[model samples]
Target: MKVSSMDESGKYDKANERLAQVKEEVGKVMVGQEDVIEQVLISILCDGNILLESNPGMGKTKMISTISKVLGLEFSRIQNTPDLMPSDITGTHIVDESADTTDFVFQKGPIFANMILADEINRATPKTQSALLEAMQEKQVTVGNNSYSLDDPFFLMATQNPIEQEGTYPLPEAQRDRFMMKVELDYPSLEEENKIVDRFTSELDFEPELENVISRSSLIRLQEFTRKVPIANDLREKAVNIASATREKEELDYGASPRASMNIVLASKARALIEGRNHVSEKDIKEVAKPVLRHRIGLSFQAEKQGMNEDKIIDQIIEQQ
Candidate 1:
């Protein structure tokens, strides 16, 4: 429901409180990276996939698994490697020999769960990587003749090690566009690292008992509410213009598509909701623009030689808008 009246405003406040609880619960197991956590939540609220890039041992898997537990969603993990096959992600039909006769039964893969963590996704082959396209876009998998629908509230978070490129196959542009955001996980600060060391090393098996902050139905309702958050006309126009300017810039060889524009606005709306605001703001758009557009745009050789990165280029585009 839209938050147009005072009654609806109270509902919005209550949802925000619950979402805050979700963050707090996640913080128990996770350290810093507050922005990263917020972006992941925003992507979930939009019902979109995520591409996480970071160095090894950055707690990407731990962060995702913890969020799944706190949200009361089923979580599955797939470790992608060079030998990983398409059937490994999407289930294959197996022969089941029962008492009466032998029959083919479909075994669902990890993709059937509510939250999936695809670790080291770039390590998989191109063919294997392409297998995720149908599921990410359509939320279903086609084996031979029959298609199986995935569970509701399905979310995929694929992580790739940015420092390694030896045996990795970079994701194609089409597949990258399917992700709503490409969140970069950076190294924690000195204090945050100290806290991480104490939190994990102090206990033998430091597994914090995280309570279910948001139930399944509550999460689904929050996803619906995220779309109802309002944005001003000027801010919406600015979001569009920021995306459009990417195409016109000479520093970039390729620009983002209309999907980038749509994601920018949608992500801004979700960010507003997460920040306990009923209306989208310019700061929200600016904050979400980098992650939304970073992976979608390509830089020219000159820009690369000039030591310019996607985030830097995106910042320039935002300023122009």
Candidate 2:
């Protein structure tokens, strides 16, 4: 079903309302880090993957799991480790000895689901990581000579431990580029923490139930609607200028690529729709810029010595913009 801005005006407005309801449904389970939740949704709206970095017990897994349930999407999780293999990540081919079969059979891995949680993803070797990465980028898996397309609306949300570096393989630039956003989750405030403790330490100690907010067809339609959201010429230039500045500055050794510019504009459009608007604005660009570009840029040795990083550099660039 093709949905366009010209097709129907109410369709866009209705989708925006549904997207807002998704936020409310997810909030029932997630405590703090509203920004993190928003960014994850923004990534989903853009049909992109995200790398979530945070400390232990920050509710990273729980949040995503709850979100999957709320969205009524098929969810699968793989705890990535050094011993993991590519065949283990994607589906593997096995010999079928049962029945009258004497041929090789393919067993689909967890990657076939609508949403995937690659837990501790950095622990896996590059080869194993690529299995997931390829599926993320191509939306399909190849084993032997056959290829299998993943379910529609496939989404990958991976988690990484920030403090643990031992035995962990850092994702290369190309692999990192596959992720459109790197969302860093933070600890909750005092009041939020108090609520967390009270909520979890209760006598019941039961998980909250999340409703399936929308259908798969609705999600696809919304993704289409996101692309059709209009952006002013000035806002588009601002996005480009910020992305270009990343490469032009000498303070950083590496900078965001052209993909970053594309993601920023796309993410900005998604954010505008989430805000119940049909068009992109400068505020939308700034709101989505940091998380969208932070992981794409690289920092220089001098910047490292001065305690400058992607976040700081992005801030500087945005300030200049």
Scored by lDDT, the top model is 1
All candidates' lDDT scores?
0.92, 0.87
- 160-267 per-residue lDDT for model 2 (tens digits): 887356778888888889999999988899999999888888857657777789888878878888998999998899999999999988887788899999999999
TM-score of 2: 0.94
True-vs-predicted CA distance for residue 137, candidate 2, Å: 1.0
Worst 10 residues of 2 by lDDT: 1-10
257-315: candidate 1 lDDT, tens digit per residue: 99998999999999999899999999999999999999999989999999999999998
Clashing pairs in 2: none
TM-score of every prediction relative to native: 0.97, 0.94
